[model samples]
Target: MAVQSWTDMLKASKKTALIHDGKRKIHYLFKDGKEMAEEYDLETDELIVRKWRQKSTLGGQGQWQVEVGEQLASPVASSGSDVIKENCSNPVLTRKDTKTSFQWRIRNLPYPKDVFGVLVEASERCIVIKTSNKKYYKKFSIPDLDRSQLPLDCSAVSFTHANNTLIVSYKKPKEILTLEQELLQELKKLKGTAEGDIDCKTQ
Candidate 1:
């Protein structure tokens, strides 16, 4: 899928059938090295959650992990109507969005900065974090970029360790920023159903 728009992006899936549990529209995509599942609110068609997993170096499939749909609200906070907020109260991880980049903070790492490494796996189009001692490992995607159909750039990824926390940041691409503005403008014209009008919908 070229992902020309938000609808195009949502429609690019390999699953044969679309499924919904009355509250959300669910879709699945399975590719060479990764698989993803997405959920969207039925009334608003807004992404509710996404989970994905990738092939492991050890030759077995890795466990499915969240790719930022539920925990992180829409990243397109271009309109005054949308202001992305972080749950700093989360004990494990918290995300902070800045003007130029997206950042994720993982707490209680207790390791030196050198022990942690953050990298972008282009094949999976996601970020992977690993420790030298093999104690901590995580794989997660940037939903903002994914929704915008943007490519992952290894150079944009960087990390630092301080105060027993590991903070990773990815520089935002210019294309994504522009697309967000356009999407926000387009979304303003559409009226969504109210909370009481929810219904089941297909992907």
Candidate 2:
């Protein structure tokens, strides 16, 4: 009997999945930063297995959008073997039942090569971009939270650039407190005036 290596053993035990009009033999083993898998095709020499990160909602329970390169693959299935991949980073994670909003400026930035990263709030989903330009502002309606938790009732947001860093401020009190405890401490550090109440800088 011939001696079999671990690689050979994994290749022999990989799970099979149909994709891109061909059957792919996927081994649930990790090697060389790539999952163990083999693609058998009659037309091409061999299919290359590429691994990349994907974004998901509900703590990765949601659907995944695979990132390929400059181009993204659609999730829609066409042929039996074709796999649809999407290109974009997943949104930041937050606690459930909490609404949050982010504000940023697109001015002077390069045209977005990937629009999947831009999320729409009202839609509570990601959208595709047709064109790229400066002065482009967008708002996203994220899941796991209500609109009331957002700042200014989901009104206009602002971003301040200072010392090569962007500072985002929210008009809501609870929202600001949720971001940092030090901020709340700073707010508490303010002193009251004798005549009336006055806002003071804690930091």
Give Cα-based local distance difference scores for all models: 0.67, 0.33
Tell me the deviation in Å of residue 197 in model 1.
Answer: 19
Give lDDT tens digits, candidate 1, residues 1-203.
Answer: 54266545434535422434644433355435567765544465444555777779997978777654335444564767566555554436666555467788888788789998899999998899999999899888887777667799999998988998898999889986666455434443335344456456774
Q: What is the clash count for each candidate, in the order shown? A: 0, 10
Query: lDDT per residue, candidate 2, 1-203, as tens digits?
Result: 96554434334442323334443323233343234333334244232332332234343523322221112344475655555544333222221111232333222333334321332344443222223443344443321124223323323333444333232322334544343343223323334133223335562
Q: List the residue pairs that clash in candidate 2.
A: 14-27, 19-81, 20-81, 20-82, 21-81, 73-85, 120-140, 120-141, 121-140, 121-141
TM-score to true structure, per model: 0.50, 0.22
Model 1, stretches more than 4 Å misplaced? 1-4, 7-91, 183-203
Model 1 CA lDDT for position 132: 98
Highest-scoring model, lDDT = 1
- Model 2 collision count: 10
lDDT of 2: 0.33
